[model samples]
Target: MLVPNDHVDQTGSQASAVRDADAVVRRCRERCDQTVAANEVTEAHWVARITAIAKDEDKSAFAEVFRHFAPRVKAFLIKSGADESLAEECMQDVMATLWQKAHMYDAARASVATWIFTIARNRKIDLIRKNARPEPEDLPWGPEEQPDQADVLALQQDSARLTDAIRQLPEKQRRLIERAYFGDLTHSEIAAETGLPLGTIKSRIRLALERLRHSMS
Candidate 1:
């Protein structure tokens, strides 16, 4: 079958266009697959890296976690009203706790980021508590009688229980308690920083304290 030359040329051009389209489709599929794989790898990579640090005390693995999280945790503390030095100190404390307590992590409960940030938030709370506590030198020991052993023990137990109760509160309630008792923020200041209503802030703090008291009792 003798075909026209122009017809042959047109057929060849159409064949070329089809091949080009197939190539484009293949490239798009490959990219989509890569993206899916990358997404799947991300969480596992963080978990494995953290597990490596926990099992082997691998400095290299810890270095990677620190590289990714420390600056972020520090910035979070600063945003939460800590001074620069306090923020840096809290960051260091958070990383130290992670190193020491990595064995306690449950991957089923939280992602690596959530776990680390929670520790960072708690460390900030501890820093606020430490700064607010009166130093030994500042305590008025006027005629400090040797306390009864039973009284001292009861007081210590109550203090420990209160601390645990505070820790068990929901994060929002805990933050309000921390700001009210530990930080210098007024209710209005916390309201402004949190974008919550002032009444809500007061209500949460009041409710949190009531819970703590009930728990301690």
Candidate 2:
């Protein structure tokens, strides 16, 4: 039976449309798969870097983490209302904790960023409490908890990493981190002194930390 010409033309157009749609679907699937694979590779790279530091006492590996995390940790402290100098002190303590406690890190449980940030958050609170204490003359003399040998060693290791990492930051971010660490002014006080909005200060600090994490990693 001879098909009508219009019928044949319509059938061909429908088939062509179907093929075009299929092609688009295949390309999208391929792109999605590639993206997933790339993400997995990046995750593994960070996990391996941190694991090396834990198992080998690898300064290079620790440097990688420090370069990425220390500045950001300082930024977080500043955001949480620490003075720059106190924040810096707390940031250093937090990094030392990371080095010493690297062995405790489990990629299965948390990402490196999460672990470091938690330490920073806790240390910031501790510093506030410590500073709130009355002067020596106001309080009775009593024994304080002595730092352990391992902590001392970990802090010693952090000196080099901290120095190098700070240099690698952008000038503004570096200064922000330093001020957050060393400036006597509290975050609110600093805002008042500098005449900058509190939200702007926090946002800049947050962005700096995120950039540091991405680039250093």
- TM-scores of all candidate predictions against the true structure: 0.45, 0.43
Clashing residue pair totals per candidate (backbone < 3 A): 0, 8
Model 2 over residues 28-113: C-alpha lDDT tens digits?
44433444333333433455566567667888877877787889888877777778998788888888998887766544334466
**What clash pairs does model 1 have?**
none
Q: Of the candidates shown, which would achieve the greatest TM-score relative to the real structure?
A: 1
| Model 2 misplaced stretches (Cα beyond 4 Å) | 1-40, 130-217
Local error of candidate 2 at residue 29 (angstroms): 8.5
In model 1, which regions exceed 4 Å deviation?
Answer: 1-39, 130-217
Per-residue lDDT of model 1, residues 102-213, tens digit only:
7655443345766787787667666657754332332111232222222222222223334445566789877876566444577676654433333432443344444434
Worst 10 residues of 2 by lDDT: 138-147
In model 1, the worst 10-residue window by lDDT is 138-147
Residue 163, candidate 2: how far off, in angstroms?
Answer: 28
